[model samples]
Target: MTPGTRKSALLAGTILSLSMLAGVASAETTVTMWTFLDPNKTSPREVALKQMIADFEAANPDIKVKVEPQDFAQMPTKFFLGHQTGGNPDIVWIDAKNLSGLDTSGAGANLDELLINQWPQEDKDDYYAKASFDAAMFGGVHTALPLFNGGSMIYYRKDLLKEAGIDPASLTTWDAILEAAKKLTKDNDNDGRVDVWGFGMPLAPLKTESSPVYISLLEQPAALYTGECEIKLSSDLGVKGITYTADLITKHKVTPQDALVINVDDVTDQFIAGRYAISIGSMLRYSVIKGKAAFGADNFDIIKWPSWTGEKPGATPLSGWWVAAWKNSPHLPEAGKFLNYMLGKEGVGLWTTVGGQVPTRKSVLESPDFAGPQYDWVRLMVDAWGQTGYMDPPSCNTRTLQGALNEATARVVLDNLDPVEALKEAEAKFADAQ
Candidate 1:
């Protein structure tokens, strides 16, 4: 070949090779995710999350996951504002209650097509119960996938129950629980004040931290909202439930009087200090209670929330964390791929193993790892799941509705106002917010 022709051919080959390298680089997509998971924390949840991201990137060499951990308290405001300005992340982990707020505003992507067209039927069937998945839908569109869930449980000192000659299982009804509490309350040192209360519950009018006891007592579905989608805080059942909760402090004198003003952390601190025989709150407290409570892990166990007569145990509603992709995410395909990866069996197992979360899939829940003596409480929680339900509140007014619920609870339980009157006032406030 002529020297000029050889040089031209070599130049064309180099140009083609460079063009191929550029195409390969452009094929790799970066999917940005925002979360409250702190990578710095060595907790199971945090470590597992970091590992999940690393594993996903390794498996999908063409996709990169950038997880930006944000301050937990500021996430809602940040996400909402980001959505408004088109600066939101491709994916986010949201609290279940908060999802409605983002979803109804059109910030969440409709995952129906993906669920139906992309996901295998076997994979879809792996969810613990269809309820968790069903709850993720809003307006018939799949808004998110269940990440983990927690419910209110009554953690008790097994030693205390034994000393009181009370079988924890027998306290399956509110009346029975109060009776047990009466027997369990004592002034051990003969001090004027009761040092050990039978039960501890948070009742402060801040956030919805104090709403669990009341919410636990109300009947399903109807307990959340009226048929018209208005707050049903003033309903007959609502009044009855809150009244019973107040009576536990005012009349029965079973729970600490200070419970009227305490929050979850305060009550939890006291619980770990061995100040109460029974405490009502989140299952997430299991880690601290088991790892740090003065009574030791062996002495601590949880009973399902008691139910009204004719109802099964754990009849209350359940709530938890969820994951979703943004509606306007630039990398929709990649976002969906990552979501499925994070929620798959290996991902769920890691979450349950490392984070101490209750598995949201039936197969995982029934797995031997989730059973046996070490997982006794998890087993009971599954039993409770059989009886509990989930009802999503209107997202637009979640903060307001939560505030209203707290205020009404304070008025009824702390101020000694009539339950019906307090709830009616809250219903009015809810209407105004709407």
Candidate 2:
């Protein structure tokens, strides 16, 4: 062949080789995820997720994960808008409270079938029988898989309790709790200002922190909601529950004058500053309590909520982040694999140890590390989880219902509105939502 012909043949071979390499590159699957966990931050959750992602890629070399972290408050709206506009991610981290609403809005791909069709029975056994698996199902359709389960606990200063001549062990009823609170409340420096309030109650207009506590106070809070999702916040029992809690601020004056404006963060900050003897919040606060507050397990501790006479103490309902695949995701298979990896033994192990989440699996929870001294407080949480009561009304409009409850609670505590009147307003709003 002539020189020109040989040069043309070489160019054609080069083109063919380049096309083959491009095909190989395109064969790799990419799964996009949207989450509130900021990978740039060195928080435990972020670190665990990064580790999980690295492990996932190592195991599945053909798949790649792309994480897009956004603000936690903005997630629900952004996910809803993305679903509406057809520009959604492959996977989303859903707030447990919003799972039903998002599932109803077509954001979640039905994962119930995966339990039967895709997942092996042995693999499924690792998850909690009802709390982890069934809790994710909305109307029998599995909307998501729990990233981890968490609930609030009341944290008390054991040192303060002893100083006030109150025994925490003897306080298992509302009456005893109130009496202890009275003792705990005092003006330490003789400045005529109450430096330490007995209890820190969250009553902010936007935060529904009081809702869980109020529910725990009820014998059966679910009785406040009908089968048709009609809220009966003005029921006699409901009134009594709200009245007793509101009295902590109004009648008893154990909480601050502006407790009506305090949210979870405010209460936590105050608790750390030694301004409150007792406060309620999530298990995530344990890190702060142990590290920043410099409080030993003896100085501070958590307990199940006090109950009415002859009733069992109640625990907060399951509340945490859940992961779900979007129905519109083009990479469903890859997304499913990623989710499975995150929920598997290795993923959950890293999360519990590093991410500081309560275990969703009984077996994992029973592990020796969880029973170790470092995580002894988790035993109380596990006990609480076992006895947790359901507070959320099963409705797609739960946010509306919760907002109504929050508004009514604020009115009763701040404006001194009658419990019946405040709750009637809340009932009207919930009925309107339905």
Each model's RMSD to truth, in Å? 4.3, 3.1
Candidate 1 residues 152-235, lDDT tens each? 678899999999899987988778888888888889899777877888887665534535435553555555566565766766
Candidate lDDT values, in order: 0.76, 0.74
Off by over 4 Å in 1: 1-29, 114-116, 210-213, 393-403
The TM-score values for the models, in the order shown, are 0.85, 0.88
Candidate 2 lDDT over residue span 1-434, tens digit each: 99999999999999999999998886889899989787666767778889888889999989999899987667867887889899888899887567775666878887765433577776677666366566557766887888777666778998999888887777777788788889999899999999888888766765545443356434566575665776567877667767877888789989876766777777777887788898766666565565557455357877777766626676456666778888888988888888888887778888888887777777777888787876766766767666754535435366566567667777887798988898889889877877
- After best superposition, candidate 1 residue 58: deviation in angstroms? 3.0
